[model samples]
Target: MTAEKTDTLIVGGGQAGIAMSEHLTDMGIPHLVLERNRIAERWRSERWDSLVANGPAWHDRFPGLEFDDVAPETFPPKERMAQYFEDYAKMIKAPVRTNVEVKSVQRCAGRPGFIAKTSQGEIEAQRVVAATGPFQVPAFPNIVPEESSITQIHSSNYKNPDQLAEGAVLVVGGGASGSQIAEELMRAGRKVYLSIGEHYRPPRSYRDRDYVWWLGVLGKWDEIKTQAKKKHVAFAVSGYDGGKTIDFRNMGHQGVTVLGITQSYKDGVLSFANDLAENIKEGDIAYLDVLREADAYVERNGIDLPPEPEAWDIQPDPSCVTDPILELDLKEAQVGTIIWATGFKFDFSWLDVDAFDDKGMPFHKRGISAETGVYFLGLPELTNRASSFIYGSWYDAKYIATHIGVQRNYVAYQKEK
Candidate 1:
């Protein structure tokens, strides 16, 4: 097979990969983006029809472009966002090799580069950026049974409410995805039961002011530094009110019962943890009270801070009822569909580097991995508020590109012999 060469190779041409490509182009770096499908294919294929971004329009832009003029200050629909990414790739002229599936990535033996084996051919690059985001793999809870008569599907596979069975639908997980799906199912006249878990919920509008307004005030958009501070901030602000949070409450208003955590599904019967929602909501509120106190302290101290704000103070309604675990005989209850909206996990089996920890994510400091030329973007708390989000990857990309440039210059001079 023919072997191509470049200064850098970026895997996964989604939001993070696109951002890295833009930064590399701006720096005049010769890099190649290898994607298994067309750009932003995940967003195009996975998200639902009524889906819109959780963040405001102003916060949705990538490196050079802004989403301000296209949609109003509100959240843009998923289709519009996908189109925006396509436009971004066109505007930057990002050299992306579509339909090239990367099979494996290994360090080039005794060379200052990496060798990527793909379905098409081999590529040699001095550096590789794993821009694949967290949603690479769907995370299903162990509580789900192996043998159940009811059909089970993850949120990724779920397209619309029509796909679910006619009887009662149990949405396992109270996160944004689970809650939104439950809402849609309830709206479609299905008897929906939502299995609530540890989740953060906030008002759609607080005191007639947009939630984004508070985000700006709290500096949720700022960059982060230091591991201790990063941990504190990540744990505190991990779940900002994505549009799904508010939709969950609306579903309750529409007569959807929020149940406890799902325990197991066996012999056609679904069991759940008793009083799970009460425990989870209590825990969530107690945690938020602490964060609120901390925020008050920060304001009282008059500290000038960065743009990213803490995520802890968002609260859920305390009056919501928690359904007891269903001990119903499978034949009697007639539950038909089970939608797992648990969450996502990272898969890095293709990366043949020692930089990854036991969790499969590369051990990195500000996007620079332990491996010499390998880097990462879109990791949680990488630079700040933007690290995990599509809008934040650009900042990380700019920094990583600058570092790569310096390293390339040093290597060129060393090879002058």
Candidate 2:
């Protein structure tokens, strides 16, 4: 079949892809965006029912559009967030083709461009941008026994309390998703046991302003993703209930059995690491670090923000640290559900290009890859700390689109000469 052609081909019609299309359109660059499913399919279907945007709507939107009917400080539900993207696509008139999956992207033999094999048909382009953001596949540890009777589901598949079997729940991974899900289950009257892991504890709001705002003002959002900072996986905070800090210490008082890291499972008994106290201390250190940073920023700038609250006021007694559940028997504890909120991983195996590192992650200077005509977007820290967020899409998209336009213009000039 004769492959369809465009000046540029963008993969994955999510916020990143659409943002790229918007910039390309503005620069008079003829491009096509291909989505495997509907626009923002992950937000529409992949997310849990009660999930909301991690960032507030005002800060997490495309600069060209604001979320209607959503308060500035409040996080919009997944449905509203998806609709906002759909509306933005229409508003910008992006040439987006839905239900088209790009199976592979490779250089055309004896040619100067790329040929993309999609579910619909082939498409050739001078440049290709892999905008498929992270969170493609749900991941879980291989600790669960294959023959266990307990119902197991990843956090991505969890909907609500009624979806799980009636009993206590063992929620693995104490990242943002795990903490939030564990809290929700506890509130729903389920005996919740949250397995703690290495995670940061940034407050949702501090001193009358959101932590996101503080990060922006303090110039932390633009900081590049460094190797040392990568270990700080996620912040234990929630946006659902008016955006509050997710302290496992406080959660324990409210019925969540905060335990240490899930180590192994055998014969229906799960063993936990005896580092619960250390984990709590680590989280406290992180939490204190953020507060100290905010305080310094306030003092240095002379900003008239509210005074910092006493640490004891916000921090609850870390009772679980001294008395932790080191082991749990599934049958004895009546724990019938194991929710894996470990995290998600990305896949870039389809690209037949030498643009990746030893870890299979695409290595690029900003969004431009070493391989000519290849670019990437929406991956965390692709350029800066904000590169993975909704707001990050604007600048990354503009930079990539502008780069493509400049290269295309130079080629045209050479041909004319």
Candidate 3:
């Protein structure tokens, strides 16, 4: 209700924010964590109805927090993850105020702090940390027109197969969201048109254990220490056809029509690039590359793991090449729904600061912003490939929080001297 002053201002109450809050609290610093909606708002609303946490619960927990009383191996659904965040916030007594949206975060012109204008009121703080996370704005490509007549759904708004039209669905993008949605639609007995690009079909499990288990043991995630390798990380396996594997190795046999990347849509005709076959080939290459890395890790560490199962053949189906859709008439194809699983973009327009780059991207080394009192967390490739991931976010938060606390306390101590 009133303008409150704090030592630090946290702009989100998600995992990163709460993690940092715990650190700041232990450091005996006054801070406030603000969320526009409920904590874990994206997990609560933006996700599809049937969507589950892409990773297992055991590996997803943050520092000082674990999924207690819950099955560690279970892949939790959207609501469950949301509740986990809510419960975690309560468990730690994080100073989170939900429904308070930050409108702008501006540096105090001649001062050593920031002023955050919010829907609730203006708050002043010596340090401001943005933990808003990635996946904020839905990215729709220019290829898709805005005035199209048929129904279009961004992957964020999608819930389940029942929400789609009674006609065929054309899913654009072949990454995790696209592949998962296409498989879901197909399982519901709907004709699915999948637009393919470079994708990886990493097996969910390898050699009697979850693939992530091997990653943990081999320190794969930690090996990704630079931004150069972050872009190459493959998406999670969609347990569609194979209950435990990706099964994209047999995409052509999955009863879904594969197409090239959507290039343009005009006059009821959608044009696609002639790169469908090439993309599929690239996917095979990615799969092999990833498999080799895993195998090499196991061998180098003298990990005498059991050999890959005899029944689990990762060999690509010979029928990968079928009729690729170069272009299609919307009316003739009878496709009525267009789903855009094109990924996300970030909008930091509200953070009125010159520390941002020409493209409005915040300039930060790790999580510390270019401006001394400002910081950013929960960004992809911030420090490592996992910087944006829940498991990796806490590390960034901890470092940033520690820096802010030492700097704030030192500044205060200087005044006393």
Best by TM-score: 2
Off by over 4 Å in 3: 224-227, 230-236, 239-243, 309-320, 415-417
What lDDT tens digits, residue by residue, belong to model 3 across residues 1-417?
566799899988887888788778888889999999999999989988877776778776776667776677677777888888888888878999999999998888787788899998899888888888988899878775778778888999999999887888999888778888888898899988888666666667666666667667666666644534436333646533333555454655877887888898889899988887777667666556666767787788887778774433445543434556677888788888999988888888778876787778889898888878889999987877678878789888788878987797678775435
Model 2 vs. true fold: TM: 0.95
What TM-scores do the predictions have? 0.84, 0.95, 0.92
Candidate 3 lDDT score relative to the true structure: 0.78
Error of 3 at 336 (Å): 0.9
How far in Å is the alpha carbon of 408 misplaced in model 3? 1.5
RMSD (Å) of each candidate, 1 decimal: 5.0, 1.9, 2.5
Give each model's whole-structure lDDT: 0.72, 0.87, 0.78
Shift of residue 71 alpha carbon in model 2, Å: 1.3
- Top candidate, metric lDDT: 2
In model 2, the worst 10-residue window by lDDT is: 223-232
Off by over 4 Å in 1: 207-209, 221-250, 275-280, 283-323, 326-330, 414-417
